[model samples]
Target chain A: MKSRVIEIVNKTGLHTRPGNLFVKEAKQFESEIWVKKGEEQFNAKSLLKLMKVGVSRGDKIEIICEGPDEDKALDSLCELIASLEE
Target chain B: MNLKDYLFEYNTISLQAEANSWQSAVKLGTDLLVEAGTVEPRYYDAIIESTLKLGPYYILAPGMAMPHARPEGGVIRTGYSLVTLKTPVAFGDVDNDPIDILITMAAKDTETQNKSAIVQVVSLLDSEERVQWLKTAKNQEDLKRIFESLTDFE
Candidate 1:
């Protein structure tokens, strides 16, 4: 598995629109991806679960990816999280 | 304020309507908000304008869309309106297009209240079973019961 910890820098954080975009990006990879905040973890493809996690700006999140595309998934998702705006 | 409180106070449920486009579908919900005095006439224009600017970023799922704009768009108070369409309309969203449910929300530039309302609505929309139940429910009382029952899920 490959993983990285990133901060949510977007003003709204991982709420409705950002969460939806995250899930959409996560769905593009075949790797099993999970997002973790504090003690809770959720499947990165599930928008509802991501929203339920209630991550906010400045909150740190850990993304873990496993499978054939783990490294690529980790890299892409890290960039996505870092670049999230609006 | 709570979901039930807002619904009861505003009677903001409109069912089985036809909309020619996504903008009109949103109009169904914004109309209720306008009626409740939660927002001014321009709030509807803001929502449509933003939709044009932002794409259908508000389309939350396959058949549900939460139409809203920032508080500065003439929000008189924090309120919400639920509009269930008789026919689903496409919003050019790839993942969550052909929306049949429009829930318009307004807030007064406050974070906590807006967050609570969004969270509550997201929870309610998360359940496919519940959303389907909502789409098919017979009357306003049914909608009231469904909204009230959200307390149990919490």
Candidate 2:
């Protein structure tokens, strides 16, 4: 299991649209990815779970990747969160 | 397609509950469905479950929440209900805090088309000014004006 904490840089946070995008992207990988804010942890592939976390702009969140391609999943997700705009 | 026909004014709501979480918002939405006669009292659980499982994602953009479930999950018909939160609730990480507007949508099919009326109504919600006006609407007449404006779009 590999995990890293990343700060949300998207101005609108990870709302429906971006959350959908993230979920869509996460499903591409064979590894299992999860995201957490504080005590709340949710499946990165579930749009509903992602929105439930209510990630907002400037909030710090932790991404956990566990699977065969853990490293690639972590790096890709971190990149996505870091590059989100509007 | 006219939204005024499907839009019902539900004044009976508990604006006090902090819908800051997904569970609360689904509860509020289910209550409205029961009030609208669209679902049986027992269906409340189903609505909540589906929302958590499938979700009514908070695409509210600002201060609105469009809570919806897939069509096959016991959606008897296509209907809409509006619920106003007294203190607003947060849906995960959306920027709009305390969602004041709750638009509950239930369709017969997930990929159903010819939803021009509903689409028009949803499009209006994208406008910040309209959403603000909806927040302050005092009565059904006031609410009607909002839907009435959709005629221009048609």
Candidate 3:
């Protein structure tokens, strides 16, 4: 298992577009990835699940990855979140 | 329960080539409300403020954006407006932006009827050809053609 926590930085937060992007990216990795915000945990690859959590800007979210490519999966997602712009 | 009855062809845009972001996107919708006489001019600011606080949520599936505000935020009645961005602007969601088609909706309540309208609109948008036609449509007649054709599909 590999995990990292990052605060959402985009001005509009993880509304729809970025949320979908994150989901699309997570689906590519052969790992089980989940995004945690508050008490809610969502499958990182499901756009609907991500939207339901309604992650906003400055919210701290935990990304958990498990599988053979867990390390690479976590790293790529961290990079993606870090690169988000308004 | 058809979208055509609820949606009309908004030919004139009061915002007029000025909107640039998610904020402006809501403004475009409210501007249509004013033109349609559904709400007051000041209502535009109210919708923008609320959506900024609550949204930027691009929930229109693939290439569309259904920008809306909750009914408590001064929605006069259940209403719908359409705005085609002259150039798309990012709503912060990559798969969704920069959005070229924005359908601003307001409902009287979360009634099944309203939900059905939303579903119908979403279904219309989900169609790739309809979305494509909406994207390339340049005038009211063109938009009307696309929207009217949706009824036949149902």
- Complex DockQ per candidate: 0.53, 0.06, 0.11
State every prediction's TM-score relative to the real structure. Answer: 0.92, 0.54, 0.58
Sort every candidate by DockQ, greatest first. Answer: 1, 3, 2
**Cα lDDT of model 2 overall?**
0.64
> How accurate locally, in lDDT, is each candidate?
0.82, 0.64, 0.67
Over B1-154, each residue of candidate 1 has an lDDT whose tens digit, in order, gives: 7655786689888888889998788888888889999999899899888778767767777888888888899899888888888889999988877888887888787475336767767777888878987898767888777766765565
The candidate, 1 or 3, that scores higher on lDDT is: 1
lDDT ranking from best to worst?
Answer: 1, 3, 2
TM-score of chain A of 1: 0.96
lDDT of 2 at A17: 55
Report the candidate with higher DockQ, 1 versus 3: 1
lDDT of 1 at A64: 96
Candidate 3 to truth, TM: 0.58
lDDT of 2 by residue, A1-86 (tens): 99999998876577645676677678778998999899989788865456544677778999999999999989988898788875
Best by TM-score: 1
Stretches of candidate 2 exceeding 4 Å from the true structure: A1-19, A22-86, B9-22, B40-43, B50-56, B113-118
Point out where model 1 deviates above 4 Å.
B148-151
Please give, as one word, the docking class of candidate 2.
incorrect
Per-prediction tally of clashes: 0, 9, 3
On DockQ, the candidate that comes out on top is 1
Better of 2 and 3 by lDDT: 3
